[model samples]
Target: MNLEKILAISGKPGLYVLKVQTRTGFVAESLTDGKKITVNLKSNVSLLSEISIYTYEGEKPLTEVMQRIAVKENKGQAISHKEDNAKLTAYFKEILPEYDEERVYPSDIKKVLNWYNTLQAKGLVTDEAPAATSTSEEIAAEEPVKKAPAKKAKAKKEE
Candidate 1:
C-alpha cells in the first residue's frame, strides 16, 4: 500500500504493525492507535535506533524531549538539532501532502516528518514486499548443515 492508504488507516483508532530492518538490527512491533504519534528506540541502540510518530490531534508526543530542547536552547547542540529536525520535517512535508498544517505547529510538524523519514532512512518503509530467493551457492551452503549425522531412530518394532 502507498502512503495515503497507510495514513487513512492511521486516522482511525486501532493497532498497526510496521516491520523494518535498519543498518543496526531488525525492528518489528505493533503500535496502538491514538491522536498523537510517538517514537521509541529499542535497547542497545543509539538515538537513531527506533522512533515512533502519531497524529497531532491528541496529546503532545515527545513531551520530554521537547522539554529538554527547551532547557538546552542556548547550547550549541540545540542549533544543530533544530536544523536537523527542520530538514526532516521539510522532507516529510514533501512526501505527506495530507498533513493538517493548522493543527500541527512548525516544530511539531518537523518532529512528525523527522520521525517518518528516519523510518525511511533506516529502511523501514518499502514499496514492495520482501522476497526470498534460492541460489546454487545456497544449496551447497545448506548441505553441510543438513549433512550432520542424524541421531539413531527410536526402536519401535514389536518383538
Candidate 2:
C-alpha cells in the first residue's frame, strides 16, 4: 500500500512513477505507457502519497481511501472512470459517505477510481494492511551506516 514514489503531474492524463531526480527536475515513467519523461521543476507535481480527499470532518489520506476501495472491490478493478458523473458520485458516496459533496467533485472521484484501477492492473493494489514494524526494519536495513569522524589528539608543549 506504499504510494511513496507515485506521482500525479498536472496536465498529464495518467499517473507516473518517479524514477530519478535531476539537477533541475526529475524523471518519471508513465503508469499507462511506461514512457519516460523529464519534467522541469516549474511544472506542477503532486505525490499521491501526500494527496488527501476532503471530508466533512477532515481530510482523508489518499492511501486510506484507496485501501477502502480495495476492500469494497475485493482488490479487483473498480467501475470504469468513464462512467456517468451521477453514477460515479453515487459509487463514491458509498465508499466515503462523509466526503464533502461540495468540495469533492465528480472529476476527483473519477481520477481516484481510474488511478486505483491502473494500480490494480499493475498488481500494485492490495487489501492487506501495511506492516509498520517490518517497514521500519526494512528501511533501517536499507540505510547505510554512518561512521563517526576521528578526533584529533592535542599536541603537548615542550617542558
Candidate 2 Cα outliers beyond 4 Å, as residue runs: 127-159
Give a tens-digit lDDT track for model 2, residues 1-159. Answer: 878889999999899999999999999999899999999999999999889999999999999999999999998999999999999999999999999999999889999999999999989896655545557778779997788998999999999
**Residue pair clashes in candidate 2:** none
lDDT per residue for candidate 1 within 47-149, as digits (tens), equals 3212233444433223223333333332112222246656645543553444455655666555443444333333444444223466979977987655768
What's the CA RMSD of model 2 in angstroms?
4.0
Q: Which portions of model 1 miss their true places by more than 4 Å? A: 1-81, 84-99, 129-159
Could you say which candidate leads in TM-score? 2
Worst 10 residues of 1 by lDDT: 1-10
